[model samples]
Target: MEYMRTVGRWRRVVRRVAAVAAVLVPLAVVSVVTAGPAQATGCRTNAHVYLTSVYPSSYRFENQPVDGGTDDYQMFAGDSTSFQVGGNGLRPYTSPAWRVESNVSGSFVFNGRVAGGNCVANETTVGLARHTVAGEVWTVRANYLTGNSGQFIQNQAHFRIFFVDPPPPEPWYWQPCYYAEACF
Candidate 1:
């Protein structure tokens, strides 16, 4: 009789525990389903995009005044696609600040930091410049939206990171005044 009672008590305890778990399990699952991947905040204004590496060989990706430029050479700034280094206006100041209408997809429009044309990647002639990369701060899987026809290449990498930052200020120049100009 005692054995029967003990068995009945265990069965009741199991039933109670399962009933609690049945209610809690669904809530936990529902929370996970509702939470999805975070969205990209798009590009910033007046920002300088640089390789995340600090090595001397680490270089900034720049554009040629060609029909378009790199964003054509490789998918991300850190990808292993080697290319010809140096081109016309392939300097740091010449490389335009990237403005994204979306995260790292669709079109990566230039902030017009450079003149004439912006998104030109002439793979045939003056191709993009790449350096002995060290590492990248972050990355972007962006498809080059050429100002020219048909578009040259598209960046298809899923999720990635690239660093786009504001250019650091130089303390050399006095902002309020310039050469030979008297202070007001």
Candidate 2:
């Protein structure tokens, strides 16, 4: 009976050790594998675009951080800031929806959509060039698309572009496990 009890106790100890190893070994391996090359991407930084209006509906300037993050845009009217538009694809020459003019400084055009419209206003000769502000600004002109000014009316609309930072690179790692006296 004494010998039997000793054997049972030893078996239980071995089983308990095995259970602990089963859970802990995988965790250790994962930690080692994932411990390398952890970087903060745009998602981590909340990077985005910023804008300020010198005068309401008169003139405005926009700024975007060089880093890749939120891509948020903050628009100001008087003393209040509202959401104008924001995203991650409004770089100088990188974004497809925008075109940069050489002659005009900071000049840009919205080849894409504005407020979900095709941006086909009456004066279709709209070309956006960056303004002289420290950030990004555009000088916009409205010309009649049909060449008739009397019949067509001209309207001024204010819009801003917001761009976020690019995403960070992903990391890779390996995992290993150990079981009591056995390596698995």
Candidate 3:
């Protein structure tokens, strides 16, 4: 009789262990499966638009006479500048023109024009540019033109280089296991 009771106790212990393992094994597997891919995947980057301009004396007046005497109205001083991103191969993003006013005495009347619309890209992937990777730098050319009275006068060119960093990877989830497993 004692031996029978011992056997029964041992059986009960084994059953309890099996039940606990059944509950725990799936949880362990789910955590591993869900976490492994997110950690293992490589980083990714996306391209975006950015514009930076200097204040005061950044642009010249077009069509105005030099010293108000010479017909040579080159980049005088005070007007908005247009910048193009990418190059001849891509359509340039043009910035709004800023007007500059100056007195004949070399004194600045109006320094620069204020930006009116949205200028920067909010998303990582913008327009037709391919997604950028971490540590990648892009060289963009800007063609500047100044105009007055609807006539273009002075022309200048510049370049802007931008650096990109990879964005964080998305988390991973096993859809089927998540829905099917009863031990959620």
C-alpha root-mean-square deviation, candidate 2: 30.4
Candidate with the larger lDDT of 2 and 3: 3
Query: Residue 9 deviation, candidate 2, in Å?
Result: 0.3
In the predicted model 3, the residue pairs found to clash are 61-76, 61-77, 78-100, 79-100, 80-98
Q: Which candidate is the best by lDDT?
A: 1
The whole-model C-alpha lDDT of candidate 3 against the native structure comes to: 0.32
Ranking of all predicted structures according to lDDT, beginning with the best and ending with the worst: 1, 3, 2
- Stretches > 4 Å off in candidate 2: 39-184
* lDDT of all predictions: 0.34, 0.32, 0.32
Distance (Å) between predicted and true CA of 160, model 3? 15
lDDT for each residue of candidate 2 in 1-184, tens digit (9 for 90 to 100)? 9999999999999999999999999999988776652421112222122222223322211222212132123222122122222222122222112233223244434532221122121112222332232233332322111111111212223333332233455765554655665543
Task: Report backbone clashes per prediction.
Answer: 13, 21, 5
Q: Mind giving the per-residue lDDT tens digits that candidate 3 earns over 1-184?
A: 9999999999999999999999999999999997866643322221122233322222222323323321111221222323322111111232322222222222111111221122222212112223333343333222222211222323222222233443456987765556557754
In terms of TM-score, how similar is model 1 to the real structure?
0.26
**Per-prediction TM-score, please?**
0.26, 0.23, 0.26
